[model samples]
Target: MTDASVLEPNAGVTLVPTPNEDDLPRRFSDFATFNEALDYAAQGKRGMNFHDPRGTLKRVYPYSELRDDALDMARRLVAHGIQKGDRVALIAETGPEFAALFCGCVYAGAWPVPLPLPTSFGGKEAYIDQLAVQLASSDPKVLFYPAEIAEMTKAAADRQGCEGITWEDFATGAAPDCALPEAQPDDICYLQYSSGSTRFPHGVAVTHASLLNNLAGHSEGMKIQQSDRCISWLPWYHDMGLVGCFLSLIANQISVDYLKTEDFARRPLAWLDLISRNPGTSCSYSPTFGYDICARRISSQSNVAERFDLSRWRIAGNGADMIRPDVMQGFVNAFAPAGFKASAFLPSYGLAEATLAVTIMPPGEGIRVELVEEERLSGTPRDLSRPARYRAIVNCGKAVKDMAIEIRGESGHVLPDHHIGKVWCKGPSVMVGYFRDPEATEACMQDGWLDTGDMGYLVDGYLFIVGRAKDMIIINGKNHWPQDIEWAVEQLPGFNHGDIAAFSVETETGEESVAVLVHCRVSDPVERQKLHDTIRDKVRSILGHSAIVELVPPRTLPRTSSGKLSRAKAKKQYLSGEIEPIKLAA
Candidate 1:
């Protein structure tokens, strides 16, 4: 009831990303013990509100109360045969139950693995298959799901011979719990599944210590205030949503208003509505698509300006995908009447392997963009200016404290700024490795730096993510593989020998992969129609998708300084809409 009881006991414990030995805070000596820092909120800390759109807002337990419940659940799970070091699969939509379940696993010393409860997976077959695969590979000792998904999950569990329990059944209204294991900070706290946009998804092992350190760094670097509130519609399955929105907000004892992913998709303005309804200094994050959705979807709707006030919005984070300058500008311009400022748009860069955040765009600054010659960009090492014809690219800002980033060439040598190569980072937040895949873990994590596979250069100490070296396509916060679409389109006669370039082009709806930028020499109109049909059918067949294919004359696709068809460059051209489907022979 008292404010003091709501604050965590370890509230002031700040972990140092880089220790000056003498200046190191004794309580924050070890990053691995960071979750223990949540003790700051152990007393009467603020509570988590699980938004029930159809029902009234219910206040769950304070940090202390939730910790007790988590301990109790850990006991129940152990009684049901869960052991220390065991993997526990949790498939629940984002809500209080998920937070509690994850905390329970952490207390029990079991690894919590959260998988996508993708609404897109109709019925139970696809999800069951995906879950089964994950469980079989992770070899989880127990699987937990909400009541709604329990039946289907149980069926999969039965087939896989794994133990399963629904949230309701697991609760059992049990008593004050059992003994907890002494969990080391370096111990695996949870497993995050790789987005699987490129290959079969693999689990990434994140340690409790790593998570705590990252949150501390993020809080300090981004200037997260205790009074701050967060409203998010990002999915819990992803790192940005889970780590950035849920964990960081709660650890900082901040109140959060979370909306379902579908809710925002259905009504983009709900984000604005939530901001208006909750009058506080709140900050939230989303991909570029989210902003575009707000601009396109909300602009057309009525009473938007009348319903929301954007003056209190301090930081509107845009990351996890390409940062579109036009989309950010459009949102600010359209919402200016509602008091939205251009400086509120905070573009950042991060990935799952890094435990979510890497850089937070400087607060209260306009999004930065650079225009350079497309031809000289690949080879020339200078920031030479070119004609204004070049497109605007956003700067994702600098790395957080204790995190060191480098742009390295193919030889692993760090390249000078403007010399694009793989973006690599070394920091306390980097995950231990991919779960069970030593080879992949080795391939990506070299020395101390994790090769992000994204291409970008640092300008004046700020990081900018350009494209993925692995050829992964991100659309609406979802990762899709280019090879998958390429293979799909290769079924066509002209594409059989890898003659086609299938890549994604960003649009107002996020990024959609165009299956073929067919380089046919033909210029006849009737033949072009046939080419379009052939490419569309091939894409739909293999990827269950179709793109707005462009049939350009041969050699239209620009090569990199090293003679590679730069997908990033190709995407730039598609976005400009200059290249069109070439005519075919009649």
Candidate 2:
């Protein structure tokens, strides 16, 4: 294998070798703990590589160097008075430094909490508030971040009365030789804050056993092979990115490439560019919006096959939010000539609460959907007077080994197959509980099964997710999913994914009403009014009811750190008059 340090400039690094049977065997399922998995993986030549926004290789970090640096950092952390079980918050930047520090925390027996970087939608104050809230919740002993965000991190740390240091300083400090803390299977590995969609984010506590078990399941379910490589633009702060892309690859000894989340947002095609360059079978995961953005960006172009080769893209994994069949189909139709197959679309269901994955589609069983009556999905009685509308619900696949999934009604009784209800799961990968929030944890846990807070149903053991229980919008007596309404607005000309937020609001007369806040950019009064009327009429036509459509300026709608629209936050902001709509002439 060529040394990573000697790689030619702009010659994108390849971590996996040409398909060879003599390659070192996979070690993810062979280990009992994360550190053990790293120890074994370090003996191999594979590791992570990072790319610039333009898809050029910038850095190559081999597993051996990672292990060595992590061990040294672990000793330094121990010398710095960071003891076992103490929480250490680190801003999850996609690079070699953060990777080393994260694993170093594991070696030192300090639980590392990965915090998100400021997103494009949220300004500095918003980021500070987000960081402060998470810090206050975890109450970490110290917070480490990249020097670029030192000011914001310090301000958040100051508000929470915790020490804040830059990653460079933290790694450079010398300490007396000391033994690293021993990590056990049951030891807390880290705290993952469920996406920012929540009004108050709860840090999900996952143990070493839970994390490893989930990683093992990922390997077994995907039927990982020697030639498989992963390319991801998912943010490291998110569970799918952190566990599935970063940790899972490390544990399984798979070569992986990364593009910063911000960079990918600007140049979505850079993802495909990197994938086309991979010499071996490629695996990647993204939310539905990611695929939508790519397809839309390349929709008008021709000769796609000449520029890209996606035939080897084995697993185009989808998760982190609702899986849209239309969006997935759009992607496949646009790229089929480029060798991308619809079967490569691997839709799975999971959350941070379950470590990462609850269920995964069997290999090659891609994008299965069942057209069920809308009433069956809403858990509402059918309206005999109206024509039945069928919604295409994507099959998220069967539960991973050792994990059990159940759909339960409101009364907590397990519902029979084909009945839509709260999605629940029991498995070794289930989180212990929310950190420092027993009441919140108790509300979701029932007799060892976790209420996923997602509405879905089972068909012959396959999980089919519909929508979030809390985000469900009820109008009169009918159930409405926010995605259905959001998608309707997106179909309008000039609108894009995440440009609209939908939720339910209580009227003055104590009746529930559908409310929509659309991000509008047009300045003309006539055009703005036309846009509003078009959206309102479209939503009304879809649901057979009127909606209060408020047109706000572009970027007015708030987004979670992971880039998903936060309906709860949007509603709060709207109610507080923070998101003012554009005024029209009388």
Candidate 3:
């Protein structure tokens, strides 16, 4: 749509990041299709900046160059017999190639399926198994992955009976200039598999209209400013990363700097370093754990003010998992000396099924919490013998533009404010249904309202999430949220988030008991037993009964692609003996 030469960066120059302000006018995703949004973004001077593991700028990908690359890719896919509505699965690696390929499928009228890459704890076989399952579920005509994982990806592709090619090799294929298929507003733009889906995957089908609407919602919700630039280290495979950070930037004509998710894991301080280096106001989003890790890293570093300048961080958006107030507070306490403002912490709620964001905290409200009794959250009667315990439920803000939220009880009746129930949302941005899963689509939808499968209540229009509905553990007819159990263990010294997974398990007596699987780093037999006993006693204090505590190796617990702890998977693996527990002293 525009001259690529005008957007090209200076040759041999790798350190210059994209400009914070653009010459082109901001549109806020007013276009009908996502391709149109990219076309307009290509006309702007702002673009994407890629950084190395240490936060040094490596590649400068302007929108014009991305558009040209996508056009060439679209032509190549057409010449290769890819047609409208065909699924083209791409192993989502954060780079210009994947970006161009994802948009290229949009141009070609094919539904681009973004799949997760191999994570740190997930081994080769586990990664392959994950890939194969998603590949089979998406049923892509061809799967493209990075060259580094060609062997493993090929094995997965073979098992699914689909053609697999590395993106680098496929980039060299013949390209013939031809007219591309036209995409409409309602056309399926992409298929996204949520981070936690493992056994039975449902590819969340999002239309061009839905994606654009959600992007606009994010723009309005955040009150995006002309001087605002985004910095992110979130994975591209997750909704918050894929939609809010990447796609939202393009549609809104906002410049963004990115550090690979794995890189952030190795050097989290690099994320702060990039933010500190930003010349303009920065807007970034991450789950609570991301904030936790960064705060923990800076605790041992010297001179927080010298290492980071967070004053320019105008919007620190939190979502993609439960927003922990304690973690947020810890972040503020750690970075306040560095000019970090607690008011910049904007909490939100969303899921892939909603395309990206369903609710966003108002621009200056920051993180708000409401204390409710533990018995209220679990919907169980309190035992008068024990002192009352309260869990702080963080306010997840109000519904985004054109989105409606309602808390419904088990009887399918709408509940009043301050009443905990299943969270249901209705909006234009909500997906029509999961791809190729009509049964699931019907089960989760009621009269166009998508069941979010989360237990929460609305207070004066602000939604507060309790926990996942399916993640709740029922023991002896009482409900116990796994987060409450896991968080209790984390309160003990030396335990951190993701180190423990709690769930319900049946004992030899055929009665359900709480099982807490903790990641144990202690090797001494005495110390190991002591840690086990401590976690057991800690859990007992909450559950009011003895519970099962098993200490597994560090990183033994499984995490979803979005980095959330997967209690269901951990429970399944533990039951199957895949997760070996450390032997206790006789």
Candidate 4:
């Protein structure tokens, strides 16, 4: 990806903030189509604001201007022979051009497929491969991206036999007067390829009604106020960032401030600085790692109170991954002097199949947790002599407005409260199906409810997410969540978040055993061996068995687009010998 800061010349003028108040009354996304929602929001003064690495504002795109550009792009699409349902792939960069093109695809009635930009981890070839796979699945007629990545994006597009155009070049195309197709409520809105989409990808097909319903639920769930603005650094390719922060702000008529995801990687503190300067109450969302990174960046000597003011940060949402309570506590501790309150930490549960939100913690009802024995989580009978061990399961709040959630057992029976089961949800916002993947869609859908593929239980109406059902490591007839092993390893000194990957592997004798790959940073052989032994002993204490522990170089683990560790991919690469462990005899 090109350095946008270098490509786009910065005007040395003060960028005014988009309005926090709109003359048009606030509505919880009642429009039938996203086009209609944008039309309604265009009447408001609120809009999107883009910031630089140091939290300096560079562009302020008002809704009216955005609507104008979108209509022009819509005409251009029509002139370019893009049909009502054609897939238009876009490299989702956090800025105005991508935003306009996305809405433009909507106006022209094309299903806009938002693809991810190259993340900090994956290099050129890996990114090209990733894009090629997703492009094959979505089968878009054309792919659009920044000019900087033309070489790589064009390669991927050529591999998939699709036309690839830079947004800059596409803007210069003919915008002749062409009739735009009218979109209905049930028309397919977009194709969402989830964060982990690769190898066999499933494009979640969502309709306009489904999208609007979800936007409404999330807006009401967060209790959007007149003085609310969103600040985000999450990649727009991910559901939480695309729907929760970007689309939700537009649909709800709230202005937003954005830091490029890569920019945030270079300077995570910029996210907080933008939040601190928000004219109104800040309502931002991120995966747990976002908070963890920000917290870790601020040291004791940083003078938090003097450097920031977070008194009006109304809703600090946590989702898209497991909401680690310890990380949340660490953030609170790091920013408590800056007026950041614990009550602002809102834990929620959601996925791409649900549009975005399945459940959102009610206003001011902060992060809540319940501890249960490891045996209950694993669905194994308790042993007589072993002392009880527990994990803190977070309260993911109740279902968003008009959504119903259920925890079903292995037999597909709805389980009672406090009984662990597979999470299932049904609502108007549920996706239509996976695009061109009926078998995959049928496997997860029962009646109208979507099997969320997440393992969790309910206490009354609130959800307590455990982990992904597919990510659970089972051995000797007992279930073990990969997060348990990963989090336990993270507790060791010299280890941080995303420093370890754990999964079941076949031993030489053909027995399934737990294998952990640690991201070793130490260079000295003696210290490296000591660290490996300590981690091995730690895993032994947790699992009560000797597991395979190998010290790999730092950044060995792969992450999903949302930045969560891809344990399945790690296991695949490790088993395939693609990931060579360091030369440490164990």
Per residue, candidate 2 scores C-alpha lDDT tens digits across 1-586 of: 2222222333454533222122577665657889998998888888878889999877777788788878877877898889999999999998887888899899999999999988644689888888898998999999999899899989999999999998877766774578886789999999999776244779999999999999999998898988888999999999999999999988888888889999999999999999999988999999999999999889565789998999999999999888889899999988999999998888899999999999999979999999988777666777687888787899999898789999998888889998888999999999999998899999999888999999998989899998899998877768899988998899898988889999999888889999999998899899888888899899997788898899998888887778888899899999899999888656
- Model 4 C-alpha lDDT per residue in residues 1-586, reported as the tens digit of each score: 1212212433777778788887889888999899999998998888988888999888888888788888888988888889999999999999888988999999999999999988744689889999999999999999999998899999999999999999988887767777899999999999998999978888999899999999999888988889998899989899989988888888899999989999998999889898899878999888888899999999878999998999999999999889999999999999999999999989999999999999999989999999989899888987657778999999999999889999999999999999999999999999989999999999999889999999999887999999999988888999988889999999988888999999999889988899999999998888888888999999988887899998898888888877888998999989998799998644
On lDDT, the leading prediction is 3
lDDT of each: 0.68, 0.87, 0.90, 0.90
lDDT of 1 at 162: 86
TM-score of every candidate: 0.76, 0.95, 0.97, 0.97
lDDT string, candidate 1, 346-410, tens digits? 88888879887888787887698987444333342333343322445579988876789999987
| Superposed model 2: Cα runs more than 4 Å off | 1-22, 197-199
Relative to the true structure, candidate 3 reaches a TM of 0.97
RMSD of each: 11.2, 2.9, 2.1, 2.5
lDDT of 2: 0.87
What is the RMSD of candidate 2? 2.9
